[model samples]
Target: MFEVGFWELALVGVVALVVFGPERLPRVARETALWVRKARTMMASVKEEINHELDLQDLKQSLLEQKKLPNTATDNLNQNILRRRQATEILAEQFEPGEAAPEKEPHD
Candidate 1:
């Protein structure tokens, strides 16, 4: 940003008045203000669009991380179930028809 002090602004106003003359200066100043307003509007819209895109990217990354966690948990749960089933089968094979089943520690 240019640091235009009060004196510099006064100097520019004086020069503009001289160049544009009393009859045209007000119209020229009004048009310049309009253009500056439009430029600010365009810049604000661009900034908003960039912020929205950044938010979307963050959401996508979170969704992917969430997806991975559920899949891992499901895989671990399936493995645990398989281990328990195998332990039950082994115990069945060791027990005779009329004999009481021996107690064993649960599978890890």
Candidate 2:
């Protein structure tokens, strides 16, 4: 990402060794690696949080759509009443001998 090459890295290492000395250089390197690992873990956690929020948003949208369905409680009750009335009419017709079946009840 930094466009750093092998020669550049070697030069930096030589400079670090000269400035910080060998003993301190190893300690500094270890600390730098620790910070890098921590940064990566934090980034991963942030990404997961974002994805989780997105999933929640999608679920909310689907729930909103479901709420907009045409088959509401009143509609379902009306449909049930209509079906029952039809069934009763069909049954009455079957037993009417030669006469026609009665009219169905009004839903309202």
Candidate 3:
């Protein structure tokens, strides 16, 4: 995202060399690179999570709109079943195999 030219990078390198000296510059650069990589990875993960949440919200909104419209008993029952199936699938995706899922309570 930065528009740093070759000269700008060279300038920064020169300053870092002068400040950190030859003895410690390599280690400093390595640590800085590691931190940048970690930050980039974390940012990517956050972006993925946000997109997933938005998709779920869209699905919920559409389901609500569908319920608001006039529909027969069969349609409503089918929609309820579909919603439960979708929700269970979503939950299953979040857990690894061998992990315990939360126990469901009796509805009535």
Compute the lDDT for candidate 2: 0.91
- lDDT: the better of candidates 1 and 3: 1
Q: Which one is best on lDDT?
A: 1
TM-score, per-candidate, Cα-based: 0.70, 0.57, 0.62
CA-lDDT, candidates in order? 0.96, 0.91, 0.94
Clashes per candidate (backbone, < 3 Å): 0, 0, 0
- Candidate 3, superposed: residue stretches over 4 Å from native: 70-108
Residue pairs with backbone atoms closer than 3 Å in model 3 (clashes): none
Best by TM-score: 1
**Residues forming the 10-long window of minimal summed lDDT in candidate 1:** 94-103
Question: How far in Å is the alpha carbon of 43 misplaced in model 3?
Answer: 0.8
- Identify the superior model by lDDT, candidate 1 or candidate 2: 1
lDDT tens string, model 3, 1-108?
Answer: 779999999999999999999999999999999999999999999999999999999999999888867566778999999999999998889886898887899998
CA shift of 95, model 2, Å: 29
Mind sharing the TM-score for model 3?
0.62
Candidate 3: 10-residue stretch with minimal lDDT: 65-74
